[model samples]
Target: MSTSTIVPRAKATGHHILRIRGYSHTKAVVATGEHVVSCGFRVNGRTWRIKCYPNGSTMEHADWISVALIVEPEAAAAAPVNPWFSFSILDVDGKPVPEHTSTSYGIRGFTQPGCNYGWAFHRFVRRFDLESSAHLMNDGFAIRCDIKLMRAPSLRLEETFLDVPEPDLHAHLGLLLDTGEGADVEFKVGGETFAEHRCILAARSPVFKAELSSSTAGTCVKIDDMDATAFRALLRFIYTEALPETTVPAVARQLLAVADRYQVARLRSVCEDKLSGNLDKMTTERNANSPPVRAQPRGHHGTHRWFIIIFWFMELCLKFLNLLGLRRQPPRCSLHHSMMSTSVDKPHDDEARPLISVSTIVVSQRTGHHVLRIEGYARTKMMLANGQYVCSGEFQVGGHTWHLRYYPNGHRPETASYISMHVLSTSIGATEDAVHGKVKLSLPGPGGELVPLCTYHNNHGRCTFTKQDNAISFDRYVARDELEKSSYLKDDCFSVRCDLTVFVKEVRAVSLVEVPPPVLPHHLCQLLSSQERSDVFFKVGRKTFAAHRCVLAARSSVFKAELLGPMREHEASCIRIDDMDADVFRALLHFIYTDEMPTMTSEEATTMAQHLLVAADRYDMERLKLASEDKLCRHLDTTTAATTLALAEQHQCPQLKEAVFAFLCSSTANLRAVVATDGYEHLTSSCPSISKELVAKLAAAL
Candidate 1:
């Protein structure tokens, strides 16, 4: 086994590099060309460097710099790993000419003066790999030793070659050009050949590069001398397109303009960045000042721009918001116009443009769905593209369009203007609100179900804002006009005015909605108060606790075991438990129903709520149990509280007791105070541990 070692050469300490005390005269060869030169390098911590001519082409006489090498300790411990090394040769002008190489170098783990050591020389050969072809041009050679002899794995040997191509000045300058269509050109690479096409095409396009005379054309800008390298850089942009970095801002802006005109998106992006950073003020300039406009970049698809790219991002945002049920639909206008003066002397002209307006309707239902209605508008009162007419028929909400058709009887429709002039002028929330109007329909009171607003409708044109609660009202003027405008509106917007200014404290169920004739269970009002019913439940399993009136029809032996009660009667008897959350057991007592358990702890209430849910569920009182479980679940941390409650609620005997203990032990203040304030007060004696905290919190709240 060939042993491997590292030899430290030198350490570059800022300026005066401290050379490794030993191995200063080690020999190295040019890895690129067959030019032999003196070794000038140092390896301090296995780092090695070879100094060479500034030109990097020929190293006939070169001063060596330092390079560092590092070898992994694991690799060193295993055995000597193969250490690949490289060096550089240079020409007299520091340009690469030809290269040389070494077959292999051996390293020993010697500790003293010289550790890394090994060498062999041979004629250099070009690798010409794709990566190399893209970045480097072969001209010379050099050699390096495996610094791994010092046991460093991360050893690197870099050959400093001379005569690297200088940045093309013309290419740098070409980045500033623009097309008449409001686009700019941007530079991607430093070479002249990369951007040639962009330069040539820009000059050739009718939208750019205007011609000028040699004499009186001093005032007119002309392309007198285009740099070949800049043109080449533009060509590169044309072929292997790319964006510009903001380093050369002016050039990048110009190049982007060129790219935009030629539909080179990649180049356009680079220019865009440069413009945003450097010439941002010009972003809003007119298209006539730049290049032919193309579609914006994919990044800007929903973005906004005046000429270059008009991104519909706002519309897209509105769409997303609509989907998420976020924003109210914006006031939509199909006809928008702007008047401009020609040097302040031109007459004002109404530049009306036809467009589409969509209205959104939010419906109250279990499922969240939106209706979009599109309406067309134009001052000309004529259908433009599609058969979109502003007729006198009632506008109905469609999938994504507002369908407006004229009534069968030919009549001049004034509803659209009236909607603009009057309907939109009022705010629905304020006295003058118009966006929304309400019509009061009297409903059932606590004792009686049906009531009518006959008096109120008769007394005032409409009900007071408070009396109309949540009902929709139309603009009386608009309603009347819409009715008159539409032979259809008489049927569509049909309504009979009613007035009931009586001081009725409560609403009754019968007046709520037209109900089918039936002797309902506790009146049809219960179904209407689903929200209230939901809030009254205790949750057990997927459903709510059985209703109080509901009786559990227990099936035999197995059911008794499931109920977990010593006395078969408690299991068998239909228990009329409170319609509260079972988690309430955690804070309050299920047995005490009259007074609110104010002193109960959140933990106790949670336990009580859960037990109540189990009792409600077992007894078939769904509403109470569901409400209890939901409240408990929402208030408590699911992990700690849910696990305990779930187990307690699962079993019967200790289910109530254990759930109560865990909840009482889990001291969350909010749950404690809620039980107190909601009139469940007797919990103070039951849950002594949290009585003080609950009292303080409830007192503070009050």
Candidate 2:
């Protein structure tokens, strides 16, 4: 569809015309607040399409006085030859009035010259702030004017959720305001006092201190004698250190008043920096919803609470500033340095700010979006949005360990908690009680270190413990068996063999030593024993581990020929295995017993990579070698890859070396990723035999 054309006729050469395109008016009482202006009119006309502010000059022209016209649909062709039109004036109630009514239109008088025609309302004197009493005409027709104007206009804000009216009791601890003269006004539970040296007090318990005194009082600003605008700003500062994202210096300067009044120099310093650092931020941003500045407030004492409120406000501001990456590295105020001893002053500048004092903070475990509401003692409220709450603090809840920390923005994150279990049993064959023992329960960290998790002392009930080969065992050590079973043997015994070794702690393994058939009759043996309950245990080396009640055994269903049987039938053959974690070993044990593998962990997967390389050489398990190589290729790191590459080279695993070299070559551009794939020796040495072109590409990239 074609666009429609709409244009206006241009004015002819040098012609002067005054036209009001639209008229809007409001009737308001005169400044006297008594007499109202009725029939207030404005004319509507246009010379060109552009509009300008209204005044008397444009309305008084006689040439266009009656020349204005409004086209009716019936007379659509052209402008009317006779354009003059007039309409009656009406009051606010729309009541029509006589022409000679009391309403006045002219500046001094309503009529024209003594013997002349009537003078129009537009012929009045110069501009005035007051509304004019005029009969406004447009296209020779009268128009109405009754628009309303507000006394004041502004952007409004809602009350913050954290708004509080009184100071918090907890904030009373170590709360002292500097009083100059190397002293502070301190308030304790008993009463208020002035002192230079403050001491710590244990009002709570042995580990926790109830009270702590500052080396020096907090920063200060004088607010009592300041104007309301300054006083109000000071209050805001106490709650939010940095002013709003856009705060004027004039407003920030008031923070000095708050700081001085509350004696919080830190807040005062923050205000000074905010005002000084970005002079143009506030003006350009135009944040009109800022805290209101009281025009006039009675007395300074009643405003005493403003200082503390200002303190928290400043705190919130600092948090916001830090979040926005605008936090300043404030220089030590000269006065503070002068007061401190020579030794203390320098450290103060170099030392990191305390965690609580730092507005920009990181917590562990917390993540995503969250809003924090902090209500200070002074009853001031501050709101922070989009902060991550991480719980770095560690604690034990319900026998589970949890760590708390924060994300960068202050959201909480998921926590990892672990529990410990101890008693285990191994079952072999159809025998009910095969092997029983006490074992420590824990998960190994990345370094293959066992972290003491939880301790579960199992007595009876059957559970399985697995080791090398197809060996399986079970524990039937029931708690009730302690009272019913009796034997001549002083110590109980069970037996099983395991090659794996682990770091040992307080928990002991069950002793599982085999026993010969009893010589005494069964009925007589039971009667001769002093105690009824007897415990069976597993034995490893000289140490004995116990199985309390029932002995549980772990057993595997299938057996296969030893892959390395031809090469080494001797059990004494020794081989070194490095970089393997306990979890992988555990998986191997589980596989031997149940023909099933344990669920893998990331660290275990790494260990599995190492195990694969070792097995490739010792047993020549081609499938295992290929599987380990594939895992290594997928998760190759510099350290592990280096070791794997070396082992592959030593074992003459050409395919493994080729895979490692390709990975190394492909990642050369990523220095860190490549270095992390640690097989530098392979890349420099064995890699050449694999691919010369890849080596060259890697060298060029590197």
Regions more than 4 Å wrong, model 2:
1-601, 620-623, 648-659, 666-679, 682-702
Model 2, 548-666: lDDT tens digits are 11101111111112211244222422222344444443343333222222345444676676674564345333444555565665455556656666666667766566555544543
Estimate the TM-score of every prediction: 0.18, 0.19
Task: Please report how far candidate 1 places residue 299 from its true position, in Å.
Answer: 8.7
Residue-level lDDT tens digits of model 1 in 1-702: 011122222211101121221121222333322222222232332223223222122253233232323232222244443444543333334333333322234432322232223322322323332114322223322223333233333322211111112322223223322211112223333333121222233322323233221233333233424443344444545322432332365455456455565554445554454433222222223222433323222233213222122222233454576678764443232111112223322333333332211111122111111111112222222432222222221111111111123222122243333321111111123222211222233322223233432222334343333312423222222233443454322222222222112122222211111222222122212322222211123343333432211111111122233343354343232333345444443222222111122234344555565555565555443344444544454344423342333333353323233333334333445245435442234344444544564355445423
Lowest summed-lDDT stretch of 10 residues in model 1? 393-402
Worst 10 residues of 2 by lDDT: 1-10
lDDT of each: 0.30, 0.31
RMSD of each: 37.8, 41.0
